[model samples]
Target: MERRRSSSCKMSLCKSASSSLGYVDSSMDVDCGSGWKYAPQVVLVKIYSFLNDTDRAIMARVCRNWSLAFEAGCLWRRRRFEMGGYRARTAEFQASGFAEKFGQHLRYLTISCNHPSLVTCKIFQRAMEAFLPKLQRRAKLKEFRFSRLEMDRYWRYEQLKEKLILTLTRFLRQQFCLRVLDLSYSQFYLSAGLRIIESVGLSCGHCLRRLIMEDIFHSRLTVYSGLRYKRAISRFTNLRTISLNYGYLSDDVMEILRGNLAGKLKTMRVRVYRSDPHGHRITKLAWNGLRRACPSLKVKFNFESIGFASDIIPILVAGIPLYELYIWTGFDDNSDWRLSSILNHVAVNFKDTLEICNFEFDNSTEMIDDALFRLTQSCVRLRSFITNAVLLISTIQNICELVEQRKLDPRTFHITACNLSDLEWAELAYLQEKYANMADERSIDFRLSSDLIVESRHAEF
Candidate 1:
């Protein structure tokens, strides 16, 4: 009896040691606790990482131990809460303990309020007033993005909009090390936008790398508003990349940017919406000065029109290192604009720097053969030249020379906008056949859009 009792105590000790070491089966709970229940903190956090915030919450409900793992800061680094649906998810993200609990761990927070109902907008506005302040004390977000998909319809909500803007501005004022802030695809009142810009320049100047406020507008509210923006942006000590709408980018603003951003600025993405009617106001002198200051600067300028407004002037500037130029056509189009002059200007101005030029004009637009020839001849760095503008077989021959002279990489040169006649079709076929005969590695592969290929071609297309 004494020997049996001693063996039983020995077995109990062994069982306790196994349980403490977390070696029990993880598949199901046994007489002893499961291995997962005793899993290491780091191991449990790794498992929680695989689950999103919603999934992690569900996992936490399984047991108290999993809930502890869910609270791990590393698992809550990036979070996104929506107001309204994702495009219009639910009506709004309700106020909850989630922000208060994991606010300290948030590194990147994106809050999108796109197409919200009146009721949801009110709820979200109030919730944000209480919510974003909590983050300022503890969460030093690396990037914070807030965007709305609503159009000019929300301009009527003046009182509510002002409150929300104030809330966001207050949040920005307290930010310390924010890196990127994107407020594109949205509209803010003139005063509200200026306040936010001022806050960013004054508060986030130390560590901000990129500031994008594209399509954010209502700038024509006051003339002195330009000076306000200039003062605000000049204070941004370390801003690298900035994006602005046509209304925001003016000669005065660019001049200020030329002095302040100079060598520090890298990219400026500008968009011109036709509906805005206000043309891009940056002149050649200002752009050239900026170029001189920042030799490594690149500009990605896009022209977008909704076709409802009148045709806008060709907004491309000469002597600027325009890396990419896209002129997109919107819905119903009949523009009284000419492309020949613009092409000539581009051929001469952007010869050394032009890389991708997508001139997507409507079918009514015409292009001169000399303009095409000069563009292909001068801009040797031009890699992707996709346009809906008409072209002939002679221009096609000029494009082939880009690959033949080894001036361009044959594998990368993508050319569309081919409109040819029956005779020209035979010639193009001959050219394609000739290139096809070359070695597989050294062959000319011109990637063209199928939609732009039309059978009816003229000798003088």
Candidate 2:
């Protein structure tokens, strides 16, 4: 009996020692009773690193050490929260003091309010009022995205919009170190939008690199309102990329952008709908002025009408070097010749510098072929080419030859017109295999649409 009792006591001691080291006792089915406490704080953090925000919150309740580690701000670097669905969790987050503790470590924050009935403007305003104060303590935030998702119609209350804009402006004023600010697709009153732009320029102009204020125009505002907005946008002197959509791209807008963002802006995308007759047409003078201001700018034009293309394309070809060009436009049957001419011009002008070219047009089938072929012949430095134009088999062969000679990866080239014949496909396969062997790289992927093949004799250039 004495021997048995002594042996049992020895086993108990062994179990206790193992438990202290975070080892589970298989026989007793027990844990270390918070053995993470005994480990290094960093090791504890590493263990919790795999857990997401909600999981970490649950883990915080396990013990005080875990709570401290959870609140240490390491795991809260990137946080995305939806306003409506997570009200309970958000309340708990605030109650637990996690907002104040974790806000200091936040680098990327995206808050979205989508469900209209569930998340009203008042609710969002109140939430921001409470949350932004805590986040203001963060010395530097990399990206701040606030989006309100609604389809078909916009929030109608001007008062609510003003309140939301005020909250956002306050938040922006605090984030002096922000780099990317995307307020795209958010409805704001024209005056409020201008104020926000001005505020961002005043506060974050130094570090702000990418600013997207697309689709902020209100229908009630006049074309003159866009001019005012442009003046405000001009204040962002250090912006690298700026995108504006659904607003008039008038002469004034271009002149303001040129005067303010000269030598600083790199990429500019402007999109306007054709339904608005009040939309200001971009003039050649305005285009040339902008080109002279920023000599190397990649431009994207998404226009509903092709009437401006005749003027726009010539100016682009004549003015600054285009690094990348994306045009999505509709054309009448008569416009085929014009489209072809514009494309050939682009090919010749931007051959050396062009890296990405995407052209999507309605109608004009065979007109694009010759121009596309010319483009391929001249633009040997092309990295990504996507077009809806049908390429001749001979053209495909030339492209493949270029890919081989230039040692360009075939995967970067995409053509969305016409499947190749078995013979042509086999030849393409041979070229890909040969290139793969020569370069010692992965197999090349040449994307060809299977739907629109046409029979044409092979012609040599």
Candidate 3:
């Protein structure tokens, strides 16, 4: 009787297990619509990976949970505007809806239009009206950028179109949260645009941080005004990085920024386009502004026609915290030893914190070789170097030597040279072999491609 009872108990347990399996199988088709099948965090991550502006908008319709994902504050943190040729309404309609839904979440925004014309400005204004209210409600907008390159107009405008232009300009000036702004218009003169900027600078004093104005035609227009800059300095007490593209910045304007910054700035990059010797002098004056603004500084310089290298070394060495340097030397008509002298001077001083250096050359081979030798000796801890010029065999050897001496196990070096001699080819072959041997020990990459061909691949190092 006891044995029979044990058998019955085993049969009952088997039946219960079978019933559980059957229920699970039957419920396989059950919809997860109302259930917490996936966590909210997981859903949020999936929404973040949507490709384009349209994809981001479509995500709002996915599931009730996903619909709310677009409204999440994190999604609108950094807005990017790809302004293509006169800010089309189609683009604005799409972007503004997305921005209106999430603008309050924005912390950084980038705007790039195909053409930065009056029409583009109008479209931007329309989008802003749709989105800025929501952004203001959230009080989260922080940084904004306006980038454009003047190209041939696709649609011409009538000369009497002044009202539309004024309206668009007013919208930009009043859009409150544009704290840090970058204008790639490159044509900002000391005219109407400057006046608008100055007006905003004084009124919107609470938030602005950095203003970078680019590509002014200095020879044709003298637009840098001392009064405007001083006003800007007084208004935006938080202002840090202020850079001008052309060499038109007056000394007084430079001094205002320098005095206000007073040693808290990190990076100051200035590009001087004029070939005047005075232009190079202006570059130094800009650096001095940064130095005066901060007791110690980090600065980057790009000058197209630098006449005197000797004058720059003192200014550069003074910024002891200066690390990364990019110099574009077009031609060395006066001195062959200039590049060498500059590198040696830097190598002797800024050897500790410097990580990357990029140099572009339109100079003699001898001068290039001297520069390479000095670079290896100085920038020992450097991790990346980029150059488009044809580096000589000795220069290549110097780079390889630097790699060895610094014990920089893994380094990225980019060199673009189309035509190469037999010896150069041999050097490449040797470098390839060395790279192969160190494939697992370190990472080294090489690329040779045709202009029209596009291919993607991944290799395990």
Number of the predicted model whose TM-score against the real structure is largest: 1
Following a full C-alpha superposition, what root-mean-square deviation does model 3 have from the true structure? 13.3
Q: Write the per-residue lDDT of candidate 3 for residues 143-226, one digit (tens) a residue.
A: 767555332232234232233234435545556766677765534334444554665575565567676765522234455544
Instruction: Report clashes for each candidate as comma-separated counts.
Output: 4, 0, 10
State TM-scores per candidate.
0.77, 0.71, 0.69
Model 2 alpha-carbon drift over 4 Å, by segment = 1-35, 83-101, 113-140, 148-152, 218-227, 246-263, 272-297, 300-317, 330-338, 364-366, 389-394, 407-411, 418-445, 451-461
The true-versus-predicted C-alpha distance at residue 339 of model 2, in Å, is 2.9
Arrange candidates, best lDDT first.
Answer: 1, 2, 3
Clashing pairs in 1: 85-89, 86-89, 420-457, 421-457
Instruction: Give the distance in Å from residue 101's predicted Cα in candidate 1 to where it truly belongs.
Output: 2.0
> Whole-model lDDT for model 2 versus the true structure?
0.61
What candidate 1 gets wrong by more than 4 Å, as runs, is 1-36, 61-65, 86-91, 117-120, 149-151, 219-225, 277-281, 306-315, 329-334, 368-370, 390-401, 410-446, 452-461
Score candidate 1 by lDDT: 0.65
Best by lDDT: 1
